[model samples]
Target: MREAPPNAVAAHYATCTALAFSAVAVPFLPEAVLLYAGIQYLRGFLYGSRQWRAPARVPLTLGRRGYRDATTRKRGEATWPVGTADGRQVWLLRQDLAQGCAFQGDDPDWQAASIERLVFAACLNRMGAVVVQDHAAPPLAGRIAAVARPFGCDLGMAAIDLHASLTPPLHLTTSAIEAALGDLGLSEKAQELNRALSPVLRMIGTRHGLNALALYRAFLDAEALSTLSRGEYEIDGLTVNTDGPASADAAALVDLQALGEAEREEARQELAPYARELACTTGLSLTDGLDLGTAIAARRLTCIRPASPLTAVLVQALCCEALAAQEPVSGSEVLVHLGELHALSADTVRRFLTSTTAAGAIGTVALPSTPDATLMRLVSESCRIRFEHRSTGKQWHTHLISTLKDCTFSRDIEPFLVERSGKTGNI
Candidate 1:
């Protein structure tokens, strides 16, 4: 017989191995090993072969007139070339894997489901159940098997959450909030509770089945609200109770006056403007919005309240803008600035800036504002220096970003912005 060429000899051995597993060993396996090996062989030949000749590339031009990608097309009066730099035409290569890479970021469901699918596949293989009736058959059934195991899915989810591969917490702001909600098992229980509540929405006038279930299950006692501190959510100085007795402990009561005075000073202390121009623009006549702005400019700080809600800083910012602007600031104007600054809702902002009751909040937006706010602002600004005792105090000053050092006290507080332009306040 004629001697087989070296490549042909190698290919013959590979083909023998492939057939041995595909036809001979397959009969004994309810397991996926035989099938997996067979499919992988084809997969390698089609996609991962180093020995195979590269597919022929045909150049195609997508013009300034635009060609179809079937999903998105940039519409503009711009002309661009889509050919090779050497003047050779460029060819488009479509890769199945490349298409997957487009949406590489993980969705929430991926954590649990991906794990479940993987573990289940392994288990199925070990159990002699990993099977491929035909090489051409899709792997949907296998994927479904892996994804459907409850305990396996749960464990996978746990593993995902436990691994903090990339993200690190700055101050525990996000993690703290999540931890405070509850542990992992609680989340699953809560999900189950939500499913149980879905049919009762129209019966009880609640829309979110999950959230509504959580709320109802949260407190078993109706009187729980009264027993809890009602002041939990209110600002330090914001609440005034006309009807209730004091909740102060004996030790607290002893220093109540001193504490009260100190807190008053805190509220009244001229805070550093994020930027001077923002201060001036808000139109607070209290000591020239410029001067207050200057002090804040000196200090790269905003109102420091550990207890402050997410809205506290935002409202403070809105007020600053209103006070700075020379024109009468309508609610809409404040909302507009807020929109420009961050994507916060007008409703959330309204709580901090506007008081609908006849008696307005201490820091309501005044149309050219009442003279009283101006006078108070002026008096507060008149003080040469307003010192705040930060937790780190002097050392903390070093950590202050230099970018903020150049900023002036600004009325332009937002969720992310530290200061605004043109206004000056002392730190």
Candidate 2:
């Protein structure tokens, strides 16, 4: 033949040997990564857990989409070979998941994650299950439900997992899955699915012979079956609402690899300032807001509002846009996710929101109307200056509030003083 291509025999032999040894490897996920950044990851994990800001709290909106977009994946059933146990087909869950993931700037392989999720969904289809996830991806209410939706309907869920987030991870249990399944409102089939799958999961655990499965079996037995079998849950749900197909649009996809390094560098240079400003506004970082705000700011507005101490509405919008990014969230799921990032109480959040809404400060923030009202009253009561707003219904209040943040935490919230050359400027 045509001079049997160079290195063909050697390549073939090497490929054969590699494929033959595929089953031979690490004892655990840790073993796989140890040769790499195992020590670094461990160090980060130990130190990082302390940095979690908010205590674990329930999500409002049940992980619902705060806003809508205009895209649709429109995937058909042929691609999703794994239909519901009763054989109900779904739309392009893969594309939809990607779009939703785009909404969050996150992406996991739909085939694999969805397969795993569908297996669990298949197992828990009869009842709403509460699964303690031991998977690589976090078992957030929205994530699980996102994968679950294309699989079936009337599935409500809640999840409780161990602190083993410290470990690379362990395995999940049938009971844990069942718990999430039943914990939320699920269909009758959901319960039946879990009941059937629990034993099967045990058998699979026995087969894999991994500790995760063994522990999963133990967890299933640890507590009596919860009253998760109630059928009312599908109607009375807690969280995990999708932003739907409308939000599935709003993106223009391109290949980063397709651009030259020079072009990429130039683009980064141009976008850096916009990125920094957005990070400040959203309380996300440059990296996090890259997929969310910069694009919008560049295309729509030069600036955005609620720049700091981000309000609930802003958080909701950021979440919507962030989800569009399809990446993991930094500050979206914890205590801060519910809108309270500071020590401020609920009343304070409401008051600030009310004031901003009334003042038309939603798009552009100037200053507080009541910042120096006492001074205004004093000036009006005592002097004849008739000190009023300048041109734009804004005056010194603009300067103070605009400067308050820069003053407040810029240097540990410096104090402000009315008189004298220097006082510990209060804020």
Candidate 3:
């Protein structure tokens, strides 16, 4: 059998020591406190340390009467109550209850936060239902959905099951959301939120037969694209400039298909060593493990636009040729092939390749001593691949517009676009 990594061994030893200390201290400490600490430690070990940290405490009081006048009020299926504090009622939804706390009062900031959480929960619950129905895995769906919940709320199966049973169900319609927010006196911010959230709502509602992973990816993509449309032009280091004229810098067209395959292969190779250990511990298949690992790893890969059009075309064509050949192609071989096809000079092609490689549009095994060394195509899967100078900006704008259309919230994110048009900036 293979030996465990040093970090893994150290982690195991620390966990065992902690548990032994807890057991020894149980006789002297309060049972409730010990239980809570144990639960928190287990949560940190299982999920992550980041998720285990406690949120800020917001004090709840009931006017002069303090806790005496506070009473639990039920609205629909919300597990938490609306508390009376200083003559103002603080509303708590099921989402707040899931996090073990609620905002202190009806301040605009608190209201806004509440509204955002409500909308997110409604959308996530709807997505979870869709996944459960489409995948025909009702038993596993609740657990999976609970794991996928946002805001570091690791809810139990019971809370998820309660959400699943909400009456009339959660709808993504504009009026429904507005009406919900209106109750909290936040109808004024409805239009602003509609712009921010429409793309994700529309993508979820219109697309059919999306699995859990696909739905999650769509959510992330739509959110990122929506932010871009609003003139917030930085997403994982990729620049968005949908309204500008093409710059003189060369553009690089990423081959998403090739990149996705490469990423999957890399994920599989990384997971292969611990396959048996993971199976015994988590009861997950290799495919399921790969899906989870890929989702996490993909966030680290950055995709940027190339500065040269010639470099962009060269990289795009080289990637296509490499994919077809199912192996890395030599720089000299590609130079000859592209020269014959595009009537390009050898020196120009070589220069473009060097520039493209430097920009990380392509990869190389090593610096070629001779012209026979292989060139590799590499890029991020999330990148858009448009080669034409005239249509690149238009394509981005069109893509965002299409995704934002037919959403249940606002019709378009034009306000952000109009505001962004007046500014002069790059990235």
lDDT-better candidate, 1 vs 3: 3
Tens digit of per-residue lDDT, candidate 3, span 1-427? 0123344544655665567666775674455445655564554444331121101111232212222111221112222222223333222232222211111121222222222222233333321111111111123332333333442222321111112323121112233223323322333333333323333333333433223222223323434434433433342355634345422111211111123333433433432222222222221111122121121122111111111222223223333233233222221111111111122233333433443333222221111112222221111111111111112332321011011111111111100111112342111
After the best TM-score superposition of candidate 2, give how far the Cα of residue 159 lies from its true spot, in angstroms.
17
lDDT string, candidate 1, 246-323, tens digits:
342222223212323333233222211111221222211211112212222221111111111222233334334323
Which sequence of candidate numbers ranks them by lDDT, best first?
A: 2, 3, 1
Candidate 1 lands at a TM-score of 0.15
Give each model's whole-structure lDDT. 0.24, 0.27, 0.26
The TM-score of predicted model 3 comes to: 0.15
RMSD per prediction, one decimal?
28.6, 34.0, 30.6
Comparison by lDDT, 1 against 2, better one: 2
lDDT of 2 by residue, 18-104 (tens): 544563564554444333343444433333222211111112221132211111111112121222211222211211111111000
**Positional deviation of 394 in candidate 1, in angstroms?**
25
* Estimated TM-score for each candidate: 0.15, 0.15, 0.15
